[model samples]
Target: MVSSRIVDYHEDLVEEPEVELPQMVFADGEEPVGVRVLTYQSSRAINTILNALNEAEIQYLRESSFGKLIEIAEKPAFSGRFARYLLSRQLKVEKKHEAWFRFAGNPIRFSLREFAIVTGLPCGEIPKKQKMKKKNINEKPYWPELFGSMEEMRVSQAVKMLRKKTVTDPDIRMKLACLAIVSSVLLSTNLKMKMLKEYAELLGDIEEFLSFPWGRIAFDMLMTSIKKRDEISLSQDTIALKGFALALQLVIVEAVPALTEVVQDACSSSESESDDDEIESPVSKARRKTLNPAHAREVDRKSEVNIIFN
Candidate 1:
């Protein structure tokens, strides 16, 4: 009879040399990159908008160009461990700026086109920033109209302003949602990220603003964050990554079928596990020949397009 010892590879575990580094360090060795994703409570801002609006207003928001944002706002925050794990698999290429990750051994590119498909956001070539700035030169500044005269307000403060009974206009409400989503969730560095006049300018012409490639802008920012993390050496202690880090996680989750089951919120119970004891994703098992071939077929059948919130 065939020996069970040969079949049970799980029992063939061997100890590998440790990288010998401090806790929360993933910039070196054979381990996954230990970068953490920093995101704000986007739900709060979204709730504020929902509560402040009437039925017509809510429905209008649902049908707007920025409508998909409502779904993104409610998505479960990506697991920090999984986020780092994806980053660790990022393959080095001849072009330093090209973002690529090895998923179940196949290379997946996180290009702007993929980002757009995953996010359903506009990905224009000319940045929204430049377009907004150019508008400022031509006519009235968008800041005065969109945000009013709050020079030093936090992103939450901007979202909270909508709560006042006076902000009943639909345009103003839409503008508020745009600002809130951008600062509080999309490109936020932290909860205290300040309001930027550049983005506010886009809100002036809602139609034009919707057409502008926000996905490209956001993807670029996300790419920039990844590049920075890549540059960090083993000695650096950069733990937190900002600016739409969740997008990177989202694209990876969309591409890798096995990862869909393992993705968790950053604040979930998985946080309790040590880096060495991190919950292995199914792809990890497949890599080690531990996963059944039949299971892989089931994974392949699941739709790759993971849009909409559950």
Candidate 2:
């Protein structure tokens, strides 16, 4: 059996021992020269070469006899601009690759310099180019095995969008909250396609309906939730309704803490402003004087006016 060990070999190749510090040399009368150390290893360093080449999806061929490796570079048939953009946005690799490969092989140069410039990876450290193989265009989307419960998918989709910073908009946030509540209710009641469709339709009647993108995200979240928990049956409709009610209650319940925080913040800000105004208020000083007056006559007169007004 062939055995292989992965290791870093570059740290082992230093040759010079430590030397004492050099005294300063006068450079006024001397010519200065600069030298750069360029290092390339032969094919004998197969493991090291393989590791370096394996840094990305790019491919390479090794020649042991010649002690050299040749990296094969090719331009993807499609425009890499959109692919690069999506990649920069950190989309899934499959999505990025699929988008790129959809563009057939047009004659384009695969520039490592451009790749480094685009991706911000070191120019010299770029890996070999791999063939961009197109996937089946008609492949049907199905639930993955990892999330066996469909409800998990639903909940998770909402979470994913929130993670993507989609819930920043108030409208989106509210819709997502509503969708979450609905999905939880549906899942709890063991509603499948028919009920799910009706729920979506009812959502349309809601004045501030979520956009298609957000709705899809909400749907995905519902599916995901079911997938995760591995439970989707509503053995008792009453219990399911209770679960649905609980889910809605949870979203509503969050608003209490949120509103409280907002109110507290507003109060604190108002108090701070009042404190700032107090520092320069002559009116406030005069008011304090009236409050602190020690004269019995003045106090009695003010009391008499209060009683007469009453």
Candidate 3:
């Protein structure tokens, strides 16, 4: 794992590596912005949000070279029948950033907590203040009505009602059913990393951190909790491991820059300490192959940093 000190150094702009490659290869006039997501987020949530925003006819700019959520938000010449919007979009995920909505824009900074309420997840464990602001969803979605005619019931009860053979307990069943419908709503986005050798160490480090973080813990808890009640078991670890393995395979092929630098430094010092008087036997001399002019030129052409990236 990358130490907090190392991450802090990068964040503080104390040690920026000199990157020569084109910055993410975006087109001219393009820029990136960071967007923060809320808890219980999923890719479908992102799609739904985008769909709503797009339907509302807003214009925006892409804040990331990659990232699906950011890419769609930033596409050029994308206008709606209503308005012309121009702003950047991208998701900023750090272990420390809590679940909330943060827009990199003026006017009002939207929070995911607010977004959840807007999306009608009012009964899904939000603060009392946020819950008080719930819109008149009475005319909104009513998959809730099918579960049963109930008042003051738990989500578990609603879920039980939906899954049972018949209408056993209407009140308890209705609540659980409502819970199921509400929980099924989409709320976030994700971009699967591309497989490549140059990202090996970065991938490895992220995996190490996320395994013990919310990524793994939340999934584990949700899966375990649901299985006993619904008779539907999902092995999150198995899924996580599969994803980790694919990511690892790509990152493992890339040389770790820090490790390589240490090795090169050691090699240089050892060579520098060696004396010119060092000698080899006649048999050893005969075993050493002579370098051709082309080979010598090739050796001189390689840069240390270039070698590392390769």
Q: Rate the local accuracy (lDDT) of all candidates.
A: 0.51, 0.22, 0.22
Put down candidate 2 lDDT per residue, 1-310, tens digits, no spaces.
0022111111212243243222212111221221111111111112222222222211212221111112210101111111121111111112111111100111111122222222221223212221113324774222222123443344335534444454465444434434433343222333221113223432422342321222223323322322232112211111111121111111111211221121111121111111212112122222110011122123323322221100
Q: After superposition, how far is residue 290 of candidate 3 from its true place, in Å?
A: 71
**RMSD of every prediction:** 13.1, 33.4, 25.1
- Shift in Å, residue 218, candidate 1: 0.7
Find the candidate with the highest lDDT and give its number.
1
Off by over 4 Å in 1: 1-29, 32-35, 39-55, 127-138, 231-238, 262-310
What are the models' TM-scores? 0.67, 0.18, 0.20
**How many clashes in candidate 3?**
21
Taking the tens digit of each residue's C-alpha lDDT, what string does model 1 give over 102-201? Answer: 5443445666656676567777687535643344354876687765675655654554555554577778777776666666556665545566556776
What TM-score does candidate 1 get on C-alpha atoms? 0.67
Point out the worst 10-residue segment of candidate 3 by lDDT.
77-86
Superposition error at 93 for model 3 (Å): 9.2
Better of 1 and 2 by lDDT: 1
In terms of TM-score, the best-performing candidate is 1
Mark the regions of model 3 whose C-alpha exceeds 4 Å error after superposition.
1-28, 31-88, 91-108, 116-165, 186-310
